[model samples]
Target: MRLLSFVAVFLFSFSLAEVGFAEENGSSVSEERLTPEELDYLVNEVGNTQEESEDLPVEVSRRLIEEEAQVIDSGSGFMVIYDPEVTKPGQISTFASIAATTLKLGGTVYKVKSDRSKDDKFYIYGNFQWLKTPSYTLVDKMTIGFPSSSGLYLPTSGGKVKQHQHRYSQDQQGNGRWIDYTIKYSPSNWEPSAGVAGSYDIRASTSKTKHKGYIGQYVYVPTSKNGKINIKITYGHRRIAGTPSVSVYPAGLSITPTTATDTRSYALTLSY
Candidate 1:
């Protein structure tokens, strides 16, 4: 798919300028919130996938920061914001806010929403920018990668094609068991772009029996420049016990970026 670009409208007011200053000075900005009409407009813009084309108007983008929305990335000239209201428990809202912001800021948003009640949702947003990238250092089974200007190679459009399998190997011994599993998935082909890499930590539960057991694998692929990373997960019964079923879908992903000062770390949760 051809990626869409947006042109931001110019509409900055004097009052909004004060809000920006307050944010820089670490002061509490006024409680002036987005109006009902404005909020609805934002929700619609973010929710509609077809319109996910370009950057938001300069005025709306600025107001988002002024309202204390969660900042995803500010390093690039275009900033990304998540709706803070949705983060609060018991609050009902749409996930399109972040997706919309990402699209407006010249990125693509990928999501997997499941029908299962306890399913963990996943979203991936990527934008092409020439910033610092991170290099990976492996220690034991865990690897940590820190971003720096002189660190590793720049992330290209595509990544490696590999699969990581996680399965239950214990002998069932003619019995049924319920198991809780937590798995960490590292994209082998992921490289830091401007000091950021995409990774996932997924937790889920499955039932196992003598005839059927839990078996799954995560498939990672590098796509074109517009779609930097692509991941698909297939998990379910290994055998047919009583019409054994399987579910194959995408996993949750997150990207972390360090501030210019390198003192704070900001994690953008793409999952809804």
Candidate 2:
């Protein structure tokens, strides 16, 4: 003894526009036939409700999406980051991406061209964040430059041992010359019950060496020209965590002023 209720445009695509009509009490729950403008309004409402609602104008949006953005290092190494999010050249966010990639691949020495910049962030990429890992150290060679370092870490979660670095470059061959100013090897008795879900691992990716105490940090304050954030690389594995197998990856982006703006980059790199 029951009858069914219905809507005519019920077959519309399940986008933001059609959402309000699906609910009974929604504003667009029409008693009369919906006009094209009303339908268009519903569509607009849907677009206005998306999670990516930084809600920039379409013209602004067109300038934000980047395709095949490339930073070519004259040194035969180029870095790349891919996303539809980039919109134009000379964008601040895009410049940050370029700098971070350069530092990780060993372009610690760089220049920034502010005259070439036209946005809020680094115009050509220049921020540098040194890795806070067991294998991280700053070796002061006669030259003021970033000591080739790795952007990886297995940081602890608690205790006085917040961050530790164990990997280092020993004496050349066996001459016994300490690479950095001070080198230390410490181990954590704490064990992590679970591992992190990294970009490299999706499901229940547990570290063989857990993270319960100390933590790695990406907090080097860069203070040089050619913008070199030095690192000290040793020959074999040292021990910041209990096992030497854990890896670290750089974790931040920032600005480093370059030359004539468009002629340089803001190089940033580090790990925590």
The estimated TM-scores of all candidates read 0.20, 0.15
**Model 1 lDDT per residue over 1-272, tens place:** 12322222223455688766654432332334445555554445344222322223223333432433332222213333231222367766565433312101123222322223433222223222111111110110111122222222222334632222111111123232222122223332233422222221121212222111111122112221122222222111111112212111122212221221111112222222
Q: lDDT of each model, Cα atoms only? A: 0.25, 0.22
Candidate 2 local lDDT, residue 127: 17
Candidate 1 Cα lDDT to native: 0.25
Candidate 1's TM-score = 0.20
Instruction: Report the number of the highest-lDDT candidate.
Output: 1
Question: Could you give me the TM-score of model 2 versus the true structure?
Answer: 0.15
CA lDDT for candidate 2? 0.22
